[model samples]
Target chain A: MKIPKPTIKRLALYYRCLNRYREEGVNFVSSKDIAERLNLKPSQVRKDLSYFGEFGKRGLGYNVVKLVDELARIIGVNKVWNVAIIGAGNLGTALANYPGLLKHKFKVVALFDNDREKVGKKIAGIPVFHVGDLIRLTQELNIEICVIAVPELAAQRVAEIAEEAGVKGIVNFSPVKLRTSIPVEDVDITLSFETLAYNILKANPEMLKLIEEQ
Target chain B: MKIPKPTIKRLALYYRCLNRYREEGVNFVSSKDIAERLNLKPSQVRKDLSYFGEFGKRGLGYNVVKLVDELARIIGVNKVWNVAIIGAGNLGTALANYPGLLKHKFKVVALFDNDREKVGKKIAGIPVFHVGDLIRLTQELNIEICVIAVPELAAQRVAEIAEEAGVKGIVNFSPVKLRTSIPVEDVDITLSFETLAYNILKANPEMLKLIEEQ
Candidate 1:
């Protein structure tokens, strides 16, 4: 079954919500409650979940633990994924320290930088290596996922290197648009902020009208 | 006109791509080029741009500078926005140092933390304040945007504080789902990685089939 991209994204969100419910000792939750928590419509929630097998009872909603486990398995996050960060900059260093990634089974096994000084250092206990050694180290460490956190100018090159290293997937934090055979998810922070700005302006139609008038 | 949420997001991406073209001294670019760069269909690109106004000439394509300027104005990035970070943790600190936000007219003017030791400290030259002083400082600094980088447990409370502070928009980096009257864009890194994992597994159907067979 080919799931829509948006549905896959929402499945991850549903998994997170279900985990929270399980942690709170809530055994069962209605689609309405899950929808309300995620700020999504109940029908949308049901449709997204329907892509997989039917897990919810008609009136009982869903079993929190069961739903979470199913989603973890469906999303291929049930096992640990050894990952590598391609930049040792501030963003990369911060992501290395991010507890959420570790909690989600994605481990930053290595960091890569072109600077010789940073190459020997460790961010969050993950040793940084020279970019020249990315292919060798990724293979040695059994790293399947690569994160591109370098600057825009260096992003494409770094992505190419990761591809050459046989990475299966990439999470790109740089603003650059990278084209590779492997699945690449661009995590553009600026785009997220811009979307917020657009929505905020849209909410304030007067502001948008004022800008248009100008 | 009500633009679709996805269109608004692609507009930001289009703006970024246009900027790169302008930097490279490309005066005009066809929808095909833009679509190719963004990995979207040309018709989709045209449809997204059509929401605002006619941008491209029939055969001559779009003027890079004009398109970039129009998108910047349409997205409300033409004017500067004073922003605040509600956490002084590693993620917040890294966001404060992110050059992309500053490039997009969103300025991080204040950082807030509950820890007394970090209250007076500065991350990227932005002074930190006690979370208790958020409302007052946001007002004093004329901050309209807030970024929530606290842990999941504290995210909702921080978002509530930001809402009570009269923030116009929020970019939530915490995994916690927050509900507020203001527009909120949740930057869930875990969800992103999970989505990547799902796509990679989908690309390699054998892996998914093996998981299912287990």
Candidate 2:
């Protein structure tokens, strides 16, 4: 069954929410309970979860552990994925040390950079290698995902190289649109700022009008 | 007139796409040309742009520079915004040095941390202040947005403090759901990993079936 893109995103959210519930020792959660926590309607949660299978009981609700395990499998987070970041810059170094990626079972196995000075260093204990070694090291380390953290101009080339190296997908951090054949998920930092700016402006119509008039 | 959330996101994309065209010296673009670059239908681009105002002509398409300027005003990126990051960890530090933010006119004016060791330091030339001074410094610097890069447990507290400091909105990077009354744009890094994992699994159904059967 082909799930809607939004449903897939919500499944990820549900997985995280269920993990929190399990941590808090909550055994069962109704769609309403999950909805309330995520600020969604009860029916929306039920509809989204229903796309997978019927896990909720008539009165006992859905078992937190069971749903979490199911969603983890469905979202493919149950397996540990080897990841390589293709930049040793601040963004890449920070992502190398980010605890959330490891918590989600996406391990950063290597860092790649063209800079000679950073090629031999380690960020968060992960070894940094020159981009020239990407194809060889990717196969040696069994990396599945390559994170494109290089500058905007170099992003497409890095992505092409990662694809040629036979990585499964890419988590792109550059602002440019990549032309790779692999699945690319963009984490646009400027787009987030623009979104926040839009929301802030929406909250103040006078400011928006003033700016628009200018 | 209220805009759909997805349309607003696409507006930002269009702004970026238009800027790219401007940089390449492309003077005008039809909806078809814009849509082709963004991998969307021409009608979708036309409809999204129509929400704000008419910009395209019958034969000339849309003037790239004029459309870019118009979008800059409509998306509220016309003015510079002062931003404060409420964590001096790797993620926060990387965000401070991210060139994309300054390019989009969102300046990182301060970074906040509770650790005594990093309190007096600077990341990317942005001063790191103790969390105790968040309110004072936020007010003094006229900060409009606070980026929450703290850990999961501290995310809510940091968001509450940011709201109390009278910031307009938040760009939350933590995995937890914040309970603040202000607007928040969550940049869930782990969720991106999960999305990529799902796509990978979908692409290789045999691997997915083997894992699911386990």
Candidate 3:
């Protein structure tokens, strides 16, 4: 069952929101609510969910606990997980210390940094090690995922190292393009800004105003 | 100049790749390179770019610098823009401090945190303020957009605050419903994970077993 790209993205959000609804003891949710959270139309939400199966009630919406369980199972976060973040830059450190990753089936078990100063340091209790130790530590811990947050210049080399490390998958955040014999997906966190920047520049032609503000 | 959602997402990647080619003094790029980098079909890239305009030469690929400039213009990153991030949590701060933002139109001008301890602190040179100050600072600074990085519990409230601040759009990383007046749209960052997670889990019921290897 290959879900659409957009749908896959929504599943993460639904699961996250469903977890909250459960904690708050909210048992039901309307598509309208999910639509509102996602900034989509109610019809779109209903359509996306219907493609999976008829889970939400026509009037009552979705059950918080059941939806949470379903979404968790759907997103693979239901399972316990160990993750490895490659690179110890600002983005990598932030994700290594991210609170949400800890709550999911993911844990940043290992950190790899080329900077001698950064190695042996810790981000959110995850030990930073030399990139040379990637395969050795990865095999030892049976790390599941690798998050590449290195510079574009180092991305391909780091990815090759990660592939050799026996990582199950890669969550890439760099702007560089990397290829792997193994499954590797590039997700640029820079896109959010790129999108916003594009929209803003479209509305305003002169860049100097923004420059002057700074 | 409203790019489709999927195409809009890919433009950033194309922009980056084109920049690489231009930096390397490569003048032309075929759709093949774009497809290869993004893991999409060459025809798909051609079709997607076709919607924008025929920037590609008949035999040669797209002009590297020219295409990049066109895309930078289309996506609106040609200028400098200020963004306000609500919620000074790990994710919010991560986004505020995300690199390349200052270089692009996306610059974090204000950070809003409800925690008294965090309210006045500066993360990555972005000043943190109380949520109460969102409207005033946003209006004064003319924050072009807002990023919601608060917890799920406080996500909606923070979004409402941003909406009241008169932001035209939002990028919501929180997993809660956010309703807004006209002109406010949220780009949900978590959706991609959820959808992909759903597919991965469905394909491999036991994610742990599949992801784990001795």
RMSD of 2: 4.1
Ranking by DockQ: 2, 1, 3
Q: TM-score ranking from best to worst?
A: 2, 1, 3
Question: What is the alpha-carbon lDDT of model 2 when measured against the actual structure?
Answer: 0.89
Q: Candidate 1 — which residues are off by over 4 angstroms?
A: A21-33, A53-66, A119-121, A202-206, A209-214, B1-74, B110-137, B150-161, B178-181, B209-214
DockQ of each candidate's interface versus the true one? 0.54, 0.57, 0.30
What would the TM-score be for candidate 1 when compared with the true structure?
Answer: 0.78
Off-target runs (Cα >4 Å) in candidate 2 are: A1-7, A18-36, A39-70, A114-122, A129-131, A209-214, B1-4, B18-36, B40-70, B113-122, B127-132, B152-154
Question: In terms of TM-score, which candidate is strongest?
Answer: 2
The digit string of per-residue lDDT tens for model 1 on A130-208 reads: 9999889878998989999887899898899899988999999887768899999878788789999989998887877
Predicted model with the maximum DockQ: 2
**Cα-based TM-score, every candidate:** 0.78, 0.80, 0.67
Q: Whose TM-score is higher: candidate 1's or candidate 3's?
A: 1
Q: Among these predicted structures, which one has the highest lDDT? A: 2
Between the candidate structures 1 and 2, which one is better when assessed by DockQ?
A: 2
True contacts kept of each: 0.82, 0.82, 0.41
Q: Please tell me what DockQ candidate 3 reaches.
A: 0.30
**lDDT digits (tens) for residues B51-149 of candidate 3:** 788999878889888898888767767665668888776667667766767765577889888799998789988889998888888879988778877
* Candidate 1 residue pairs in backbone clash: none
